[model samples]
Target: MKRGWWLALVTTLSSLVVSNGAAADQSITALAPFEVFADGFRDLRGIAIDASGNVFVADREAGTVTRIAPNRTRAVVASGLQHPVGLAFDFAGRLLIAEEKANRVVRVEANGGRTPIILNVTRPRWHAVHENGTVFVSTQRLTRDTDRDGDDDRDSDDESDGAEIILALTPSGQLRLFADGFKGLQGLALNHTGRCDLQDPDSERRERRHARCGRTDEPVQEARGARTRQAGGSLPHG
Candidate 1:
């Protein structure tokens, strides 16, 4: 099963129209693409590296979280999830997951069990790391029917409540939306001073266009106009 999935993913990614600038810098100098890691993941969306260098992957299609050890041994850390994507670790060593289908973020305890950390999170895809034991999540806003089948025209505000919100979840379990109004924002990260930054393929293009006019520092806020067209989604938190 895993072999088949890996093959499919490799074929799909090879055909994807990725950003040239970002892909150019992501290559590993010492390791070839095939040798960088094992070819066993199927629809792997997000990945997180622990302080000890262990790799945690969110397998969306498999609905599981697989941990890759330094020795390259793979094991399922958590399973039975509903399309888990973004995986992050809190300050106290809790495994946090953003389950897209469930529209919530759950935490795996030290005992290897799961608990709901935050729910109804508007299709969260990426998470941002913040100081003082805070984690920020990026959620997608409900919008017009992408399928154009005239199915989602019932509630104009249904997606508004779930609209792109950057949530700051405290270690003590408190949650708050720090920012909002992004379309399909994912891949969140924070700069040294705690500002949230994300990579949106559409927004990046807009930034490049503005760079022609010498606006190098694209606005450091939510990407209210951009959306993601990628298959797998995950938040990489350091």
Candidate 2:
């Protein structure tokens, strides 16, 4: 039996809607509770709203992508996914999905088709978009394996050794690391100024790791790498 671990903490950005006739630019306010969308979602993780206010959600346990219209009608748009965790958009009006288990990012077009954008990503937990047509993806270190007692230890850290990282992918498919040293990188976002703002629920684990190694020199707060937001740290926009 394979045990799975899911982060219970929900992170979100509230947005103020401004109408522009056919489309609108939503301004994020704060994190709000997830309101039930017709009561059919099981463990909904990542959400993305399109220009028309159509809500798209990636259901991890259901392995499906759902579309919730303004009328509160729920429909499964795609299925058979490998635990897709993050969802975003590209410059070409394509839906980008971060498939966590497959370590790949894929694109779903408007015609109900899918294409691979980037593959072999390192434990991508979530992703966000930038105005410059660049896509940033976050990687968390999660693995599933059977333990000695025949029980799956989903949170076991016996095999993890690398630090978490956020990678930026250019339009040409070139990948670059934007940030590093995150113990358990989860949700990632890029603000209007191209600054990457992210949150980690398991930051306490990193502190414990530092303390175990007798690293008293480390700051008791969040890691230094997380505090700095670099402009143009990502690839140039196409």
lDDT of each: 0.57, 0.55
In TM-score terms, which candidate is top?
Answer: 2
Q: Write the per-residue lDDT of candidate 1 for residues 24-115, one digit (tens) a residue.
A: 66753433243345445667677776766676778777788888788988888888776787877776777888877666677776667676
TM-scores of all models? 0.62, 0.63
- 82: Cα error in model 1, Å: 1.0
| Candidate 2 runs further than 4 Å off | 1-38, 140-161, 204-238
Residue 44, candidate 2: Cα error in Å is: 1.2
lDDT of 2: 0.55
Candidate 1 residue 154 C-alpha distance from true site, Å: 16
The alpha-carbon deviation from the true structure for residue 121 of candidate 2, after best TM-score superposition, in angstroms, is 1.5
List pairs with backbone clashes in candidate 2. 14-29, 15-27
Model 1, CA-based lDDT: 0.57
Off by over 4 Å in 1: 1-34, 142-163, 171-173, 205-238
| Total colliding residue pairs, candidate 1 | 2
